[model samples]
Target: MSNGDGSAVRSYHDRTKHSPASVRASRHALDWANQPLAFKIYETLEPIALPRELPPIDVPALEAIARIESSTANECVPDLPTLTQLLYYSAGITRRITHPGGEIYYRAAACTGALYHIDLYLVCGDLPALAAGVYHFGPQDRALRRLRPGDHRRTLIEATGDEAATAAAPVILVCASTYWRNAWKYQARAYRHCFWDAGTLLANLLAVAAARTVPARVVAGFVDRAVERLLDLDPGREAAIALVPLGHTRDRPGPAPDAPPLGLRTVPLSAHEVDYPAICAAHLASSLETPEQVRAWHGQTPRPVAPAPTGPLTPLTPLLGATAPRDAIDRVILRRGSTREFGRVPIGLAAFATTLERATRGVPADFLDPPGASLNDLYLIVNAVDGLRAGAYVFHRERAALELLQEGDFRRDAGYLGLGQDIPADASADVFLLADLAPVLARYGDRGYRAAALEAGIIGGKLYLAAYAHRLGASGLTFFDDDVTSFFSPHAREKSVLFLVALGMSARRAQVVPSA
Candidate 1:
């Protein structure tokens, strides 16, 4: 198998070395205005109206992926209420705040600059209330707009090279991101935001599924053109990032009839658009044109092997205990948001350990650190954890213990690493995910770039769930790429920081009680 050493990957890797080019000269600024819309709308197809009144079933809060207790692939056939709940929890509006400009709505997950680029689409066979068709999830209205009417999972089956789970699934969810939405703020790096935002959202969706007993698996490998065409998307502006096959069904996929080209229009998100050439270039470079390419892309490789312990493995006996009583996702999400302000309080070391252990048990994925291992490393700045000295530590998953690296009051340093954010200094601990990119990129190519970010974001998402389950607070943050690894020194020299999450007790408690 050829490594993702293609010119596309090489160009991307080279671009990373060069200093930031002038924004004036960047194609992202000029070319974006003329680029085609991300999705191809079908004017002929009527919109499939989704259920407004969603299910009232309260979903249990799942703290850890390993602690997920469902084995059955059977789902509840998602009535209007269940579907509404899924949509709301997955990408629905949780909060709206008024500002000088106007009002800004925040979703269930954290996004870069709050510039939401990721969009959700649902394709399913005829179910109890809904029909067999492809529909677009509109978080704006909390409804689904029908794109095409029929069982469209077959296109996914073909795109995924007939992956068994996708082929047998009842409903498949597709996640796509429009570049300009996030690129306006992040510039070329909007490409990275695509996966990061998607992973954070998927974290919610997956947890919701676990709570609802829906078996879902994320499929990153697929024929790019097929999916792009099925969604009527222009390859240059937007593309499919990931696919989730929801609910196991013995019923096989029906034959995929030809989907004709669609030319529909959508309201422009913003007046002016900015294009990132490097993002477009890298995306095109890593794109798989044929199903054969997708098949050959995933060559069998030996899973990662953990090295023998070099020193004493700290046993985390105090952390293990029964998880919090199942809290509903609706309540958790309503209470969830990025912590802009944090109060310096000492959280119990047991609570910290439990949160880490529960969150990192393992995310169900084909490309993972190992069967039970993860792709990213968890490093933390212990500002204040009861019974644990304030310092920097590396979480040893195998031993379920945090190995002390440097012991000191590094609140100031923690803030600096988190791009000089106040929350890091105020929080009890800052969790950073570090990874050896060379191996991951080698095994999975440029696509591995997506995997690493997604894995970190998913874990970060779980961290949010874990914190909220214990009535704590958490927030996703960004950091200086090289500085994070530098702060952790010799131990994390080769590793690069993928994502950051700050966890602790909230400074202010909400007075209003959540509805039952």
Candidate 2:
């Protein structure tokens, strides 16, 4: 039951690694008839419709993705319309394609298998055109369904162990994932997708918030059970993943109302539910049980052991501050989609370098001490990037350069490492985030697993936006975890692979807007 026991998380990660023999030996199949519902339906709760006509966030997408911290220092309480805009661009349905079987609803962010398992909820004090309450965002209807009535920000403040942003903010957005919705395709591994999918969505959220100059901070360390009780989430199915407090405020919350169960009924996700004990067990293994634990867990960023590179180095030319592409963030997010097939073409070294530099700048999270530290290291498989040799390399984030690990055509190796997928082979580059979890788990315990995975997801999400900012394409892919570490060995020795992203020109542009 101790969250500090990291072996539980390690065991789960080892069991889920996909190998050539393991993939071929698998017997998993999708059940189209029993597919889980995309939206969490509360049939009894009346929908409070959000504004339809939302304003465009005109900040250039590149600039927005480059900066993780909100620009504003002054107190800024967002109006209802601002909230609507935030929600729309973050998780709203952007477009849909009608098919003979059904319509495929495309969202603002990319998700593995297009499962749309991640959900958003808002907890706020009374604001213009909105009442004080806890509300679940129903993306299907573009509405908020009230779950608790009254100011509940104090509950989150306590849940986060009095995180500075949570204590000062007037509103908090809770990100949660319903396992079966994604588990239907990924099975037990869907637990990892919980953070991966949510991280992509958060990239959009943080960008939109920055575009509007709203103060926001990502609080990942929290008393898990308290927040679950406050939100009334079913421990077996849906669980809160991260908390983002938006728009600073001077006034403190007086107190919180009781969070007794309302026993609200929800429409079943599918015709039948199959339990995945591994998912629940892994979650429980890393969960924080008390505010004291959460308090002790925050602000302890581990210094991952990495020696100075012995290989050749290539300095990155990232577009410095204020000189970036002007594609509006809202537009970029709307146009974003997971590129399926790479064009097998070369992209500018600058474009690829910008993604690495900007995405790894730093994330504004409670788990990151001094605000700029990170738990993951960036390793790359370069296949077709212009002005960069075709080879494998490791990113020297501090020096803003790449250290060549090996020089050769790695397309064949990339394909094999990415679970034998063609995307990584054809893409201009593939980024694999590796973390030495011995130090991470030692510093933060099993909860360090959550920190590492969440940070990987957030950076992968940023990489997605950074690629799209330059009109390139990007997609997150699963990899042979141990193989990835082996490929970047010596430097990446003893490190665990947290996430992988493929970047390049799409073979053909994905349909951002469906044709009539």
Candidate 3:
């Protein structure tokens, strides 16, 4: 497998899959004393404090999540206060938990192992309060530290091949991941976590942008080396994953000034870090090198047309009228947390249907073809839901219905598929996101893996918000990859599992600690 071929990604996927037998055969143990720090710190740079005093948006969570386009005109630009609120609610540290050894700072979105590996950066022209520059977001201090002293939005525009969204945007945010931060726990599979964690953050960002009626779009196609150079990142250690254009403006940026080397100082993540060659190889194989390749990658691919519904289909009954929850976007995010324990309580059918319908409507992304078509299929193991049968079902987004596949109680099977976890067994339903990787890789090359995982994470994030808004609980869980596919065999025999989310009522409420 080489950098130019898609076979590398397929080989990497096959090599990293987890199974019951494989788990016992491998002897990997946690290095507790050598754990890497979760946050990146710039030792020499002075932090320009961001305004902590901010007001919450009044848009309802459901209304915000359901919005695919902004109602306000695209000429509106986001001011400093609005930007502050967006960054705070998207990735800021919202809660802290104390234990005997130390304290843990939980962030706005859920991450695998709570290892906050993803970092956000801002690139913008002169705004109301902020100067024209490139800056890194320091969630640790709730501040922004300037990395470059002038407008660099044109650099991103050129790298993205003058993408429509980038051409007309006033502000753009770059999301990157530090491999060692998450690899310390997840090992080689940390590559997948890069997109998952970033997608969760984007989920929050898109919803908030819509609530404020700001135009935004997620750009996944870009020249990898150009972005790394602009961010001053070591491609091997830290790599850019996605670019998001914030608010739209009619004014286009001029040619960017020369980007020179700035050897800045930063605190190390740990005393020593371990390297995973497989992770690096996979990333390299999927990287796009030229503007032409980026443009070609953006071309739409024909998705397999869905066959007419022949199986028994149950139309979804989403709560749309007066019964929908009116919680604000900020309040929903602050209250969002992974459910540690799910009580065996059946949720209302309308609530369940609404969550599924609203979350899968579509994501404003570059990789998805025809704008609204999804790369992954939704599969469910229904344990409890009012007016729904206890069995397995596959969601047909085109028809907005669930096609019954198997009819029987499989709570124990669900638990086993989720790596022997009790959450899936006790939850009302376990939503499994699976994708047919063959066509995806064939169309977009190895980068499709990132797109598939990211789509899952975004939808999973929306599910978390939906559950919380409706007064339910949801948690993103890991599962045995092959087992998940096998459990939904025949219907999903050729597909691969991308992500899982368990939804139900929480047995105990989580405590929220104020930020320090």
Order by lDDT, highest first = 2, 3, 1
Ranking by TM-score: 2, 3, 1
lDDT against the true structure, each candidate:
0.73, 0.88, 0.87
Predicted structure 1: clash tally: 7
Model 2 ranges with Cα > 4 A deviation: 321-323, 509-516
Give candidate 2's TM-score.
0.97
Q: After superposition, how far is residue 394 of candidate 3 from its true place, in Å?
A: 0.4
lDDT of 3 by residue, 441-494 (tens): 888888888788888889888888888898789999888999999989888888
Model 1, poorest ten-residue lDDT window? 16-25
Residue 455 in model 2: shift from native, Å? 0.9
Give the per-residue lDDT digits (tens) of candidate 2, residues 266-369: 99999998889999999999999888988988866889556988999999998766666788899999898898898877888877788888888788899888
Best by TM-score: 2
Worst 10 residues of 2 by lDDT: 507-516
Using all chains and alpha carbons, the TM-scores for the candidates as numbered come to 0.88, 0.97, 0.96
Clashing residue pairs for model 2:
none
Alpha-carbon lDDT of model 2: 0.88
